[model samples]
Target: MLPARHRMRRSADFATAIRRGRRVARPTLVVHLVLVEGRDDPPLVGFVVSRAVGSAVVRNTVRRRLRHLMRERLAVLPPGSLLVVRALPSASKVSSADLARDLDAALEQATARPRHLQVGRSS
Candidate 1:
């Protein structure tokens, strides 16, 4: 479980990271997993639950489920990476098993590596 501050905080940060960060994205019926390497340990995982996905409570439910999944599975991920798991509209209608399967698939794709860069280079 990463601290709140280290998590992606702003829309701009989310947009920027997704736009520019090299990523491995995979889609499942329940969620969309987009991951990119980030800073050192306590690797952050962000959840995106836009209105297109669900109502407030529904969105929060998806976020909580995904967060729990991350907590349980983060150990399998490489250190110093950022993972963003976006809830698809279908997430609101899925069971935990469905979410878990989607998450597992996404996690597999996210963790596959091609050699990540250090946080800073070309200084």
Candidate 2:
């Protein structure tokens, strides 16, 4: 389980991160990351494991796996970052190692460049 300080609890925070964050999608999950400037707190993480993934039991299982994975990777994020991991149905069938690899890849892609900076550059 994540410490209280590292959890994203407010609905508004989730909304902002989803709406304004950089997104990186993997086969098993989609990650949305928003970097909060000038704040000194530890990065906050949230998870979305919807019914589409499975029944309550399955969802909880996936959530637990993700929480454990995130706890280990939290240090990869900078202070005040907000990260939301939305699990795809495929996530239910993958191993923890696969999930961790996807999570790490997503974070690396999400934070590789500032969103605004990327906006003015040509693809």
Candidate 3:
């Protein structure tokens, strides 16, 4: 679990970060992942679980698994980036390792995709 200070709790931060950050998405056996790039030492990651994902128990379980995976993979993620993971209904049935694999793949693809903008350009 993220420390109290690092956890994403406010609606405004979630909305703003998600809106501005770039995303890479992929489907897993029981969940979906959405990763957005940001700038923190161990990359900030959030899980989005709505009523559609499952009941309260299921959602909490999934979140716990994701949080564990995030902690395990923190060292490998790009430094100073924000990643938001959105869980699909299917995720209620998958294992933690499977979710980790899905997250890894998503992050790899996100990092590999080309970005259209360059800092030095002028119109």
Candidate 4:
């Protein structure tokens, strides 16, 4: 489990992150990352497994898997970053390995560069 200080618990925080963050979409998940500048706190992570993903049992299972995976990958995020992972319905049917792969790829893309800026500009 993520430490209390590193968990995104407030609904407002989740909404802000989803609204302003960069999004990385995968077949089974959508990752939103918002970077908070000049803060000393560790990154905050949250998971959203909607009813559309599955029944209560399945949603909890997916949430648990995502939490475990995020714990392992927490170090990849910058300090003060907020990450919200929303599971797609396909997530309920995928294996843990597949989920991990998608998550890693999403994180890589989300943190690399702003997607919009990457489209037409050169450094």
| Error in Å for residue 14 of model 3 | 1.3
* 18-112: candidate 3 lDDT, tens digit per residue: 66555666675222222333333345566787788889998898888878777766665555444567777777777777788888887666656
Candidate models: Cα lDDT each: 0.61, 0.85, 0.60, 0.85
Cα deviation of 54, candidate 3, in Å: 0.8
- Candidate 1 lDDT, 22-86, residue by residue in tens: 45443433322233345455555677878987778887887888777767787766655555667
RMSD (Cα, Å) of candidate 4? 6.3
Candidate 4, residues 1-123: lDDT per residue as tens digits?
A: 777877998787687679878999999999998876655578889999999999999999999999999999998988767789999999999999999999999999998862221121111
lDDT of 2 at 64: 94
Top candidate by TM-score: 2
Model 2 over residues 15-102: C-alpha lDDT tens digits?
7678888988999999998877666678889999999999999999999999999998888888767789999999999999999999
- Return model 3's CA RMSD, one decimal: 5.6
For each candidate, what TM-score against the reference? 0.72, 0.91, 0.71, 0.90
Ranking by TM-score: 2, 4, 1, 3
Model 4 residue pairs with clashes: none
lDDT (0-100) at residue 5 of candidate 3? 41
In model 1, which runs have C-alpha deviations exceeding 4 angstroms? 1-6, 10-13, 21-39, 114-123
